[model samples]
Target chain A: MSAFWIATIGTSVIAFVLKYSGHSVPERWLSHPKIQRINALIPIALLSALVAVQSFSEKSQLMIDQRLVGLSVAMIALFLKAPFPLVVLSAAVSSAAVYHWL
Target chain B: MAFGAAAVANGFSVLQACLLSLLTFSGASQFAVVGVIGAGGSSISAIATASLLGTRNALYGVIMAPRLNVRGFKRVVAAQVTIDESTGVALGQEQRGIDAVKKGFWYTGIGVFVFWNLFTLAGALGAQAMGDIRAFGLDSAVPAAFLGLVWPRLTGKFERILAVSCALFAIAMTPILPAGLPIIATAFIAIVIGMKR
Candidate 1:
């Protein structure tokens, strides 16, 4: 099999392990303050990294473009506590509009 | 939902996209995988990054295990549907009772699972019909949606700073690192801060 398939299978397997381990493992082990703290912070950190890479980088190069505009608008909407769908729509529409102009 | 479209837009086959939604069932990690692959990154990196992102679900599983109390086939089914929406709904129903919590979990979990898969199929088909993803600027939707997802989570100064620093760090490392490693490296910030306290 190809690397792509290998990668996909590996990811699926690990993900299953992560999910399944929850049921199998003892709860006290996972409730440690440090583990809890890491869990809480990981989402914020990982999501932010995704936002940066997807918006600022294109094919591994940092390129400023309409995505930046869309991200800015979405960030503002999110700051205002806008609904998820609304924030996503505003970002898409704003980015599409900017892409049209450019 | 939107991820299915994004995956298709990234040049994945419809079957591949649906299989991802089916087998993986985690939206963010699935997106990360497709995003990495779309950018010509290696498969190993894609899997590693996605699994790192998915570690939280295991945390969620831990929280739900006692409350769920299933066995055999039901346990397997419960595990598959154990996601954010289900957990949130289950917790929300805590005021009612245990039965309510179970209902909430099962209903929300099954609901999202069915709808998510159906919509994923729709999105994949729609992307195929559209033919030109760039013209619609659908690419931007990925980051936009992710930003929206994380937006509410940044509830304090410390969290906000940590998020911004991670993003900047990933961007900075892009030039020096390989395709998918920079994102994986973002974990260091969380690790450092998490270990500090």
Candidate 2:
């Protein structure tokens, strides 16, 4: 599991930088609305990249897996404004049922 | 959460499973790595596989650094606690922040960290007795946890739309892509959408 730890440490350090960098480093706050808007996009940009990578890739293959299904169910739950716990449970149950059956 | 659940399902001893949680501390990474090793992959391959899936945590750091800049001992500890939920929560408070805004961030980040790991151990310990735990349908716990993390941040149409789109993208891609890459794609879509605006 050294790989796990390596990724953990590697990912943690980067996450720290992204999550805290704006507040941590004493960069002069930009007054430009455009710059502010662009900067604002950074977190969302990174978040999407991160989530997409995690959701789609696994074992270095490109097969549709249960995670995808579970995540889809999760999306539906969220759209319905289901409570967070319920969304999660629904996703898991749907994915598991689908995975087991198929 | 899924890591521990998968471990139990695969018949690992409680001790081994708990140790995975305590030490590995990575949900997807641990789950993916173990599956490979269990399938007879070499240590190197398993490690590489897990590392590949875990690359996002690093990006999390880059996103988190601005929100939490603790130094010295606390910095180190805070660094450890930085994960998906914590980083998102911390950053979500940026525009209309309050006194407890910082506290809210920390609560999300560190709180989830300690409890996730703790409950991970709890599940691992229950492995032996959790036979047929699938009946309880514990597999959904990770997604549930993700929802918990993402739910609180659903403030705007953009954020909500991004989240829903990504979730759907992840699910749709599940049958098409490899294991962990769906989330990556979803993340990319969100980023593009955010940048396009």
Per-residue lDDT tens digits for candidate 1, residues B14-50, read 8888877887888778888887777667888889788
How well is each residue in B1-197 modelled by candidate 2, as lDDT tens digits? 45566556545555556665554455555554445444334445445544444444554554555555567776655655555566667667777765344676678866776776776666666545666644545544443444444455566887767665665565465556554444445535544554567
The number of residue pairs in model 1 that clash at the backbone is: 0
| Per-model TM values vs. the true structure | 0.95, 0.52
Measured by DockQ, the strongest candidate is 1
Fnat of each candidate: 0.64, 0.18
Candidate 2 wrong stretches, greater than 4 Å: A1-24, A27-102, B1-3, B6-70, B82-113
Residue A71 in model 1: lDDT:
87
lDDT (tens digit, per residue) of candidate 2 on A1-102: 544344334443443443334334344443345444543443343234334434444434434566677777877777788876577578768776876787
lDDT, model 1, position B191: 78
- Against the true structure, candidate 1 reaches a TM-score of 0.95
lDDT (CA) per prediction: 0.82, 0.53
Off by over 4 Å in 1: A2-4
Determine which window of 10 residues in candidate 1 chain B has minimal summed lDDT: B130-139
Which TM-score values does chain B get in all models?
A: 0.95, 0.60
